[model samples]
Target chain A: MLFEVTADPLHPQPLIDHVRKDESGAVAVFLGVVRDNSRGRRVLHLEYDAYPEMATSVMRGIAEDAMERWPLTDVAIQHRTGRLEIGETSLLIAVSSPHRAEAFAACHHLVDRFKESVPIWKKEVWEGGEVWIEGEPVERS
Target chain B: MKARVRLFARLADLAGTRETEVELGEGLSAADAFRLLCQRFPELADHSDSVMYAVNAEYVNSDHSLRDGDELALIPPVSGGDRAV
Candidate 1:
């Protein structure tokens, strides 16, 4: 129940704390950090944007799907937007379950779903130029 | 009917603005509206084959009919990077 899309910084503590349950024994966390380089470009900074409402709704759907597939105690996710520097946390996901295996698998699934389908965007600004990381041909197809 | 078109990322950059108002015929689908948008902006034709259409925050197909006041967003391939949580 921790689905969110925000411009503020992200922390796993709240999400981890959220899934703490008496019955849950494992809490798996997936942290997405802004790296210094992408596709060989020395990224100076990154800008993230999202259709907040839609993004959060999609996050909820992803969590729901994970819950249905795994014996999850709970799942939470948050994606940060706006300017982010190298090494900053950009996405955080926490999944708690009865055991370690389910927690890990669910956490991985949630991240993949968000990265592939959410209506969020990333703009990588390097020294000379910047471009949106749309994962396809940059020029007109 | 009229709809609010929202652009994002490279699409927004190519259109030279993020949001614009579009007027369309009664029975035109989202695909038709998209064609019209590219007619006005021209640059958006670059993504014609790949654009994903969303109306009112829910993804829909090209043949989906549009309505007044609907918010139509054209999504490119979402490649949200590994950034802040």
Candidate 2:
């Protein structure tokens, strides 16, 4: 299991390779990239900041939850913090399992839950000004 | 009790400091601490509805109990990028 909050770009291949095993014939990976547009505004770049202490703990908890919920061989999650340009890789998740089905499901669950629970904030640097974009809280009305 | 209250992004800017030691009354819950925080920084009042609290590095509900020397963080509604794993 691997969980990290880093400022550097996520190299998915390395993470994927690390979890690859001959017993697990399939490996699934997901990469979230910075896009050029958001909510009809043209975004120039995104600045990601995390409450590191909490962010890592939440991420690790997500990983542990994924393991308990799935029969996966290995799981790795990496998220980049700091300023990133459009098209940059901001987050990566890799999962390996004996079969492809569990790998895909675990990978999706990890990312989805991470977004919903992690304390990460992204600032949208538009042409005019930058606005902080906070992630949704765990509790919602 | 002394708890390190951490603020992130816009909340940090509004609070004027990244982290502060919040002195709380005995047997204070996370919600109680939050009320005091709002009182100290009135700017946070506007966001209290959407804010979430975390204790000991995990997201917790309003009723989560706070102990002495616990680390608490205030998380605001995320608007921009998607969640990463």
Candidate 3:
């Protein structure tokens, strides 16, 4: 139930609080933000688009995968879709586990897999142009 | 048969719309439906190789058979990244 997709700006503190637990000794957090530059271009902002229902379902699958692979106590992942300015947070993943190792490992695994499998897209807008970053390549046309 | 097709990211931009309804033969495959889409939006034909198909929100092979009223999505490579940009 923690996985979600939103069009609004993302905040990480709530996720941190949600994943916090007395039984877990360690928590790992990952925050993804839009930066000021990309491929030597001054990035003005980014626009993210998503198939909301599938994206959320995919995120939930990632959290479930992480729980199955590690001794994770809880996992929460939230990603924002829509235009965002430089340094704005776009994604957040929080994981709690009995040990730091499990927490860290699960967090890393979730992010990587989510990037590869989730149905989300990002467009990098620069001063003069914009382009979609690499995903599954659009080669046929 | 009829299918509700969804386009995302670059695909949506190419088509100038997010969703469309495509008519398919009774036994048409997902790939055939996609081909029909490409025919409607020629620009999408160029990305045929890089695209993926999802039936009912679950990723599936292009050869998967289609059913009437199924919701299909044309997915461009997802751009989930950890980098700041």
- Could you arrange the candidates by DockQ from highest to lowest? 3, 1, 2
In model 3, the runs with Cα more than 4 Å from the true position are: A136-141, B83-85
True contacts kept of each: 0.58, 0.54, 0.69
Task: Report per-prediction Cα RMSD to one decimal.
Answer: 3.2, 2.3, 2.5
What is the lDDT of every predicted structure here? 0.86, 0.82, 0.86
Q: For model 2, give the interface RMSD.
A: 3.4
In order of listing, the candidates' clash counts read 8, 5, 8
Residues forming the 10-long window of minimal summed lDDT in candidate 1 chain B: B76-85
Of the pair 1 and 2, which is ahead by TM-score?
1
lDDT tens per residue, model 2, B1-85:
6999998889888989888888978788888888899888989888877888888877788888888999988888753237432
Candidates in order, TM-scores: namely 0.94, 0.91, 0.95
Please give the range of 10 consecutive residues that has the lowest summed lDDT in model 2 chain A.
Answer: A132-141
Candidate 3 residues A28-48, lDDT tens each? 999998888876788899899
> Which tens-of-lDDT digit does each residue in A30-131 have in candidate 2?
888998888889999999878776777777888888879988888888888899998998888899999999999998888778777777788889998988
Candidate 2: misplaced stretches above 4 Å?
B78-85
